[model samples]
Target: MLSPYKVVTIGDAMITMNPISTGPLRFVTHFERKVGGAELNFAIGCARLGLQSRWISLLGKDEFGRVIYNFTRGEGVDMTHVQFVEGYPTSLNFKEIQEDGSGKTFYYRYQSPISTFTTEMMKDEMLEGVALLHLTGVFLAIDPKNVELVQELIQIAKQKNIPISFDPNIRLKLWSIEEARKVYEMIFPDIDILLTGLDEFRLITGKDSEAELENFAAVYNIRDLVIKDGANGSKLYREGMWTRVSSFKVTPVDTVGAGDGFDAGYVYGWLHSYEPDKLLRFANGVGALVTTVSGDNEGLPYFEEVDAFINNELIIER
Candidate 1:
């Protein structure tokens, strides 16, 4: 089957590490490495779901950067827009998982090559073929230059009538609440599709009613609004219709990146002309599937996997 649309995503990518041992740090002696970045993961998810995805980033020339670059390339995401810069070290992050499945993450991305990105790096000619532009809040806070670039990209996407998908993957540790709010307000008016976690939405908007959700969408003229509430599933609002889709049952390893995976699934539906219910079901399934494995994108389902899951066909291991 052909993809619903072609996409181009922009943001930072980094090496993610999680302790192999479950208990205290003193006893945890080893760690497993994985590559994760909000936009990067979204690109992988889209590609896995049978879409043409291109991920653009400024990575360091270090081994860590090479690891992400090679892995992303191997995953079938277009890497022509990715540039590995010399003299800058790739970023690293560590995830300390608690016994109860909670995780604490520490980031070391300051001064990374991606933080030096500027608008001159964007490839405008490529936008002609792209069906959508994907972005996250992470890049806006990474650097002032990136903030300018985000605005420029949004404007360009609007001019070309290309849909813009945004996820406010809020990382409070990276920037202050005030800073995040400022950027959100500036871009809120331009977002065509808004994917936000229920918690994050409440945290930012301070309102929990469906009316509040619709009010924001109506005022902003957002065509698609998805509110993801983990475990309980997600709800989508569009064109005066509201649909709630249930989450699939799965034993979650690490819940990080599920939202990004879900975004990919929902965007796939939008690309392929799926009805709202099917879109949410597919998105919820994709989100839950990603949580079955430890790393971010490791559990991202391929087309066959998604098909099997949605069709109620289970694969039993021998």
Candidate 2:
């Protein structure tokens, strides 16, 4: 058996909705509820691939919230830091899936209980057994209190010599570009592994070329940097070496959660000490597979699925 590394994820968890069609003209819709958050998705993705993962967040005292808590716990995720809040509503996101698997997502999340998390709620030992602390920019974007609390969490991780990974999965609906720019500036120096999209790079550096993106990562001294270009593959910079990795050629059913799947796949590769190229391949394979289904996190391939997909045994179609 492989050794397990304790992975810690911090962010908001929500109820996700994805509609599926059953016919050409008339469609029957079915809903699958799961814990959905950028960081939480990454953690769940890691857990699905056999890592010992944990999640920390504030869940509302509601039926929907309890469902999320129970589901994740049942998946073998440690929920030691999850707090049940009495007066707040859990966040919710809805996706409308077309027959071809394309969709639009809407978020209903302001004033969520998770955004109310404060530094006081965290303890030093909350991170005791963590080997890696994973965070998403959405937490910082959601609230100032969460930003401060995340800063504290990062400090604790640093103090304990635990590496930190950041996915600046920026949501333009959450804040103004200027506000996000300032936050990124404040947090860049603290991030170890930085995962972002080409749009994020363009927005952050005002640069359109991969050369400029690589230069930007070098300027920040990030150990592992990935610039994701949707469906076009991703570029990675590590240990002063840069590599352009091609993505799997597949017709996407829905693009949502694909990047999160990529983030999860890359984290799994990092935790398991896979080679750089293999890591990129694994990440891209999972990302491609995710698009074959709907929802923010459904169809996230497990280790077995990933292995089969990468080996070309599992043929994906449009």
lDDT of each: 0.86, 0.81
* Cα lDDT tens digits for candidate 1, 225-259: 99998899989999988999887777777687898
User: Which model scores highest in TM-score?
Assistant: 1
TM-score of each: 0.95, 0.90
Model 2, 127-231: lDDT tens digits are: 897788888888888886677888899899989999888888888888888888888887888888888888887887688676776677778778898877878
- Tell me each candidate's RMSD, in Å, in order: 1.8, 3.1
Cα error of candidate 2 at position 109, Å: 2.2
Off by over 4 Å in 2: 19-35, 96-104
Off by over 4 Å in 1: 1-4, 23-28, 315-318
